[model samples]
Target: MRIADHATWDRGFPVKYLLVQEDEDGVEQLWGRCTGVEGFFVDPVPPPREILTLRGCRPDGLLSEVLAEPDVSLRCLGDVCVEVCDDEKPVQWWTLADAVVVAHQPHQADPERYDIVLGAGVRSEESFFELPATSHFELFAGTRVAAASAGRCSGVDGLFKARVDLAPVPMELIGCEPAEPLLAALRRPRRSERDWAYLLVLDRHGAVMASRSVGLAITGTRPSVLGGILVDITLTDGGNDRPSLAARPIWAEWYQGSPTEPNLWAPYDS
Candidate 1:
């Protein structure tokens, strides 16, 4: 487990770390403990030098470039992996394995930053899960996962694979615009008004690993086959909520749509 109370700005300077905190009025303020590094910024606000100590740090998707560097240490907190920055001991940490439910809470100051709230052992239907707040998993919620395998496909060279897990209900895929080159290589004729399905691939812990929308064609009568051009994968960085994918994999599972979750309307005939 890695914990951090400060942010690191990796410029070629003696002091590369700074503490970011909110004042009593809830405004973000930068604080420094070191001396003789005033050339980098306008004001070097001072704080209690004695209490300013380093500790273990957590690295998220923003640090993807940094994590790719040679010999960066890493550790896993539950299913999420984080980069190790310093030798200091971590002050706090949490595990997803112990969580019964996970809720996403966006940071007030930074819109991109969100904290993953894990519900304790108790399971309740009337909690934040029932709130009107946008539930990211609303599409597949209350639906069962059906396992289907995909083979290594050709002509999908440039496009990355993004798996869409489904429930029993059929739903439409939203927010996908494939490049012209990919559309031209497909065997079927492309159309502007064609219906597409939005898909999401989640890790075992229910963290969104990747998502995309693809124009799928359903064929046959009873046992129908679904075909679609693989779209470019949109990898997510759920802030400190989940770990990022190391690399894209081939053929993620696509579940069967159910009527219960009407979000994804079933296009196949009975």
Candidate 2:
């Protein structure tokens, strides 16, 4: 899917919709409604009016104070944790690594288990704010990777599954493994012209009920250069306004035990 296709939802600004339901086994299933019509899913639009895309930056390069300026958000999806500033008009964001701090409840059991929470002002070590009463999220201690991989099977045993729908394009999912060097999943044959890639990583979780995707503009794709990839940053006159997801029916059908407004497409699609 072309990056331009994501502008349909709210004009040029895209919104990410999420619906969650529990299965008969009581495990929660998340039905994510994202932008992109032809199988490619871009992260939600950023808050900044203008985005400056940079290509060929070292993936492992230490972000400098100057380059990591205010009002800019970066979109690099994978197992990495991110910090999005909701209060800022331009929403300064960055990939969170050593800066992330997960705290476990004093009496909490199995502190390693966690859930994915997506929204503005999600409390992290680097970002903190007073959340509105209507907000829903979970704060627990564990590595971001551990949270994403919990309650799933297959892949690297304790690893998590990453379902990426960037069709008609070849992309790689690379990350580090326990006691092993950096690893990259082999690019599998596309199931169809609209197929999504499923790779394994040691990562989001039960506590993590939701999180917003990043807005990205990709002019082209090429292999990583010096462990870095390049992108063209587009800037806009974005305001400080934020968008909230309302509960909506994912399907018209209603089951006996379904809520008044059913949000999940089906209980078993995942």
Candidate 3:
């Protein structure tokens, strides 16, 4: 498993690595252990710390410039190939036949660093056939197994949702502007008067403030898709609080109206 943690300054810097861990309760913990060397900023220009090769069936020039370089290490635990490289150096690479990989990344300025991990596993092959007056017989024959049976066979089977411990970083408000770019991308033309909700805090200068998980919303749209013309907005404010303000013209979903029956909503919460 490969795991990593990193941060970027407003001035830009090299992508530093960190350590991360998840407890039984699914809480993510982050620790920073390495400081990036100066002159590591490659935001406008590519860095020289890692590079890509054609050795492991990875065709050269077949990958994206942003994804080709090894910004972080990666590994596979089962029947999967993995390669890790930076701008100029190849860090680590491996393949697994039947295993899992876990990657961890840590937040910056932590007491420790964690690696981002990815896990993989392959299913065993099995064959079955019905007995009859035949010369050959299948290696395995039986009724169709239920999905529950396979789940039971797994040693530790369950979806592993990643947890990230976002550090309290200084967020600068760039500006409060309409999120027209976002709405255009969504291809929703009928949306009218979509405005974000939140405070727009700024720093000492005219520069905007920045923070994590600050509530922002867009309200204005006809009820339509889900029943009537209703404004559908998404709020993403779940990190530490900092100086910030809401921007306007936030992208939102257009709901048509309420549901015909309240029972339909029950399954969603469950």
Candidate 4:
């Protein structure tokens, strides 16, 4: 299945949609729908609309002055930490990074393992009022990959699984280890053809993250809708032994004649 469109709700927001189609033997066969978490950020309070005139204020000096000023509110979403400037003077200049702070919380009663860092501001929005500087500020959150399921056929047995190693690595990679007899089972083809394909990656907990109705071609036919197919793609481990899997399903369909397209038929002898 190929994605017809992938769209997000808005800038600095996380909502999104994935549209897919499946075709086999030149005919449309099946479809799939999947949804999951995406990361985004919003700044409710942007720099003041009116520009503040700093006749001789050096850029650095202006920022430093603003740092000491009051009326600025900074909050970290992941750790839920809020910092407010108490100085009465207005801030003249400020670096985006300096204004933001990550709140690292230690495990209660235990100092080794961190409970969680609240510095992440995914899906959070900020607001700005009349201020002392003219600057563009952007909020960004790291990307995360999650899985969701669409439609499936009972004839397509077997599960898809994947896992992500928390450990660091040079590059991301996905590996597939099919059970023995995989080749024979797949080679002994059927007359109807397998239109839908599934890719499953097993996580540490054995849960599977699957992408279904992926598009692929088979037997020299270029169907409009295609299903997922498995290919041997390697990823650099970067020095880490463990890695997560990226799996998706492929579906194919036979072609049906369109209203304007001419139909060709072979003569049948009776």
C-alpha lDDT values of all predictions:
0.24, 0.24, 0.25, 0.24
Question: Which residue runs does candidate 2 get wrong by more than 4 Å?
Answer: 1-79, 82-247, 250-270
lDDT of 2: 0.24
Better model by lDDT, 3 or 4? 3
Off by over 4 Å in 1: 1-194, 221-270
TM-scores for all candidates: the values are 0.14, 0.16, 0.15, 0.16
Q: Which candidate is the best by lDDT?
A: 3
Worst window of 10 by summed lDDT in candidate 1: 150-159
| Model 3 ranges with Cα > 4 A deviation | 1-176, 185-201, 213-270
Determine which window of 10 residues in candidate 4 has minimal summed lDDT.
246-255
Candidate 3 overall Cα lDDT vs. reference?
0.25
Which ranges in model 4 have alpha carbons more than 4 Å from their true place?
1-174, 185-191, 215-270
lDDT of 1 by residue, 103-154 (tens): 3334455544433332222212221222122211100111124311111111
Q: Which lDDT tens digits does candidate 4 get at residues 66-165?
A: 2244632333211111111223532222222222322223345545322221112121123332332433221222222321111111110011112222
| 1 or 3, greater by lDDT | 3
Q: How many angstroms is residue 128 displaced in model 3 relative to the true structure, after the best TM-score fit?
A: 35
Q: Per-residue error at 67 for model 2, in Å?
A: 22
Q: Can you write out model 2's per-residue Cα lDDT over 172-242, one digit (the tens) per residue?
A: 21211111111111122222231211111110111222232222212232342313231112111111121
